[model samples]
Target chain A: MDLLSNLSLGFATAASPENLLFCLIGVILGTLIGVLPGIGATATIAMLLPITFQLEPVSSLIMLAGIYYGAQYGGSTTAILINMPGESSSAVTAIDGYQMARRGKAGTALAVAALGSFFAGTVATLLVALFAPPLTAIALKFGAAEYFSLMLLGLVSAIALAHGSILKALAMVVLGLILGLVGTDIYTGAPRFTFGITEYADGLSFVALAVGIFGIAEILRNLEGDQDRTVLGTSLGGLLPSRADLKRMVAPMLRGTAVGSILGILPGGGAVLAAFASYTIEKRLSDHPEEFGQGAIAGVAGPESANNAGAQTSFIPLLTLGIPANPVMALMVGAMIIQGIVPGPNVASEQPELFWGIIASMWIGNLMLVVLNLPLIGLWVKLLKVPYHVLFPVIMAFCSIGVYSVNSNVFDLYAVAFFGLMGYVLLKLRCEPAPLLLGFVLGPMLEENLRRAMILGRGDPTIFVARPISLTLLLLTLAVLVVMFLPSIRKKREEVFVEAD
Target chain B: MKNITVDWTDAMAGLIFILFGLLFGVQSLGLEIGTAFRMGPGYFPLVLSGILLVLGGLIVFSAIHDRGGEGVGKMAWRGLFFILPAPIFFGLTVRGLGFVPAIFLTTLVAALASFKMRPLWALVLAGAVTVFATLVFSYGLGLPFRRFGPWLEF
Candidate 1:
């Protein structure tokens, strides 16, 4: 009954006319960019973060939540049609979905992906409503030691999940933590790394870093290819799946949702990891195992459902602990801070409407995607034909205006350029940017907690091991590092990443 | 000397991290490095810089000896030439030239990154972006940007 009432309040908040309009705009815009190659949800939201500052806290957050999941929906469409996933989470979907498109079953593949995502989204929303309250209660009891250890675990897990050499990923995370400490120190008011620039006293613009790393770096990578994408030019035959196809999909969707809900809760893993895990499981379980790479219906359905569920449930950590599980969640933390609402457990109690509104908006946004996108498939396909040269310039122009409008500071624009170059260089070295962003967001909080805990314990240094929760988290962090370095697991990890790539 | 293999990509990446580590480490040492109970601003960063330096060294050591040398691909030379400067140009000129001209020029510079783009198409794209950005950001949202700056005065 308590859960019922909470959800009702959430629905009431999300269903209002103005909120509905903003949610709709967010989903549409999210899809539009998600359907484009080389622009991920992280960059699109980063570019749009400045615009949302003008809106209400609840509305801005609702729209942002909508963009995050809406991109998941649109990502599958490109995976099926062009053999190029517009978002990385949908990468595995391209394996089978594109094959289906090539065989003139594009419509069936798209429909299956949409329906599976809708079902998973529905289940994940309920799970979030059910689990978030208890998690928040648990998080509220945490102290500085527990918090510090938890963030360390998160950073280490992030490095574990990243592609290529774990050493490089660890290096990126430390670099981000250092970069994050660039502004004035909170305890002493002394500038750490501002290099005598007054404009940077408030710290480097998060929007600039995100847009530069994900946005501009991506553009340069795309430019290296300069090759045109081969869009499936055949007219889609039927949007409905056959009865046999439906029967094959039901079990995978269920299993995928289950796998996704669990993995999505862990720090540093989300939709991409969930989808890959789901696909691998489905492939193993299939009676016709060889059909996986050649376009099995389950291959498309399972990962699509898993990724959508993972995308929705990833919000659990953000809403409950105020800690971001991924880069997109990091941006949410940034948004919350900018709106003068500190992220974490208190948000659920102090601002019930804002908290629940985002929860309810996830389902509503998913429903809109299913209803709106299937019919608008033609338009997205047409958009795939637009020249790349025209698109990047427009995106660049918007990135400039958006970064400048945040504080009306021209210096942020320059920061965008500097970070953009750095991002490109990092990308050249095959480094993943996701962990770096997560580290940047968690850095200040990590330092604050470490200092506070040390002070609280009178510099004993054993307090981290003395406390049960902190010890457990530190143990988990150590376990992850040990596993990453194990030769067998390292080989397996490289194989999985190679297949995904 | 028969098999002196070094993954250049990993080596370069390691060197970049080392440079950043040394930069932050030396700077943090300049600030106060107090004790644990009552820490200074530099204490945390200084420790992190040390960790980073150690990590960088490990990466370089691994890079020098690794056999699976996945060579780095072609660099985006043309993109780097044009795209990196677009925002810098916008930042420098937005105050003096006003929002309209600044945005137009910025977009124009970005378009030049692609060899496939023609001059007339780039001009038309710039004009469209200027008008649209002006309407939406300036007129619609009512952001406080001057239509024309003082430098534009005759």
Candidate 2:
């Protein structure tokens, strides 16, 4: 009855005309970004964060959440039609989905992806509703030391999961942490790294950094070697799948959902891992394993289902402990701050409507995607024909406008250019920008918690080990680092990233 | 002579990290570094800087040890030349020329980065973008922006 009441309350908030309208707008915009290969949801969300400032906090969050998962649906479309995943999570979907398109089963592939995603999304939503309350209760008891260790575990795992040299990822994280220390210190109002610029007294702008590294940097990378994206010229064969096709998809969809839901709770890009895991599992489990790379029904169904499930469950951490599971979640943290809501365990209790409204909106958003996308597929195909040359200029103009509107600061614009250059250099050096953004977001909080914990423990380094929860978290962090450094695991990790590239 | 080869990408990356570490480390020393019991603004940053330095050195060592690695790929010099400055141009001119002119010029600059874009087409694209942006952001959303700043006065 309690769960039912909570559900009704959530539905009540999400079903409002105004909230519904914003959610629709968000899903549409997200799908647009998803169809376009040049820009990403992270950048789109960053650009829109300023615009969202005018709406109710709950509405803004609902719209933002809509965009995140809507992209998952949109990404699979491109994967099937163009062999290019607009989002990284759909990279695996491209493998078999594109092959299906070539064989005139594009409609089947698209249908399977959509249906699987919807089924998986429903299950994940229930899981979130079931599990979030319990996790928030547990999070309420965490002290500063425990929080510090938890954040340390997060940072370490992020580096471990990141592509390229672990040393470089570690360096990037430390570099991010240093950049975060630019403003005046909280404990003692002394400016740290302002370099005599008062414009940076409140620290570097998060929006500027995000837009630069993700938005402008992506533009420059694409421009390096401009190439064409192929869209399937044939009309969609059929929108509805045959009964046999649906029957074949049943087991993989279930299995993918289960796998994705669990893996998504882990830190460091779990949705991406979930999709890849689902593909590998389907290949192994398939009766005709040879059909995998050549176009297997399970191939498109499983990963899309798993990826959606994973994307939904990743919100569990941000909603519970205020820790972002990936870069997108980090932006949510920034968004929450902008909306005057400090994201933490208290958010659930203090603003139940805001919390539950977002959860409810996800379901509404998923339903909308399923309803709108199949009919809109033809429209998206037409959109894919738009050349990239004209697009980047508009993107550049938008990035400038979005970054400027944050605080009307001219210096932030300068920072955008500076970070864009840095981001490009980092890309050429084969560094993953995701981990740095994660580190940047977590840096100030990590430092603050460490100092607070140190003071609480009277300057004793053993304080971390003295507490049970803190000690356990530190041990987990150590284990992740050790496993990453192991010769066999390191080799395996390299292979995974190579396959991804 | 013994053969000497380096992965320039890794070497450059390592060098950037080193420079960043040294810069922050030296800067941290200028502030008060309290004892472990109480961290000053400088203590945590100094410690992080040390980790960065060690990590950078390890990266450089690995890069030197790596053999037959792919060299740094072709740089996007043209893209960098045009794209990076577009935002700076906007920042400089948005206050003077106002929203319409600033955004138009910024879009024009960015469109030039691609080799496929012709000058006239770029101009048309920039103009279209400016009109749309002015209509949506200025009129529809009602962001407080001057259509024309004082610098445009006759």
Distance from true location, Cα of A140 in model 1, Å: 0.6
lDDT minimum window of 10 residues, candidate 1 chain A: A66-75
User: Mind giving the per-residue lDDT tens digits that candidate 2 earns over B49-137?
Assistant: 99999989888888885365696687888899999999999999989999999999999999999999999999999999999999988
Candidate 2 residue A42 Cα shift, in angstroms, is: 2.9
Q: How well is candidate 2 docked (DockQ)?
A: 0.87
* Cα distance off (Å), candidate 1, residue A402: 0.5
lDDT of each: 0.90, 0.87
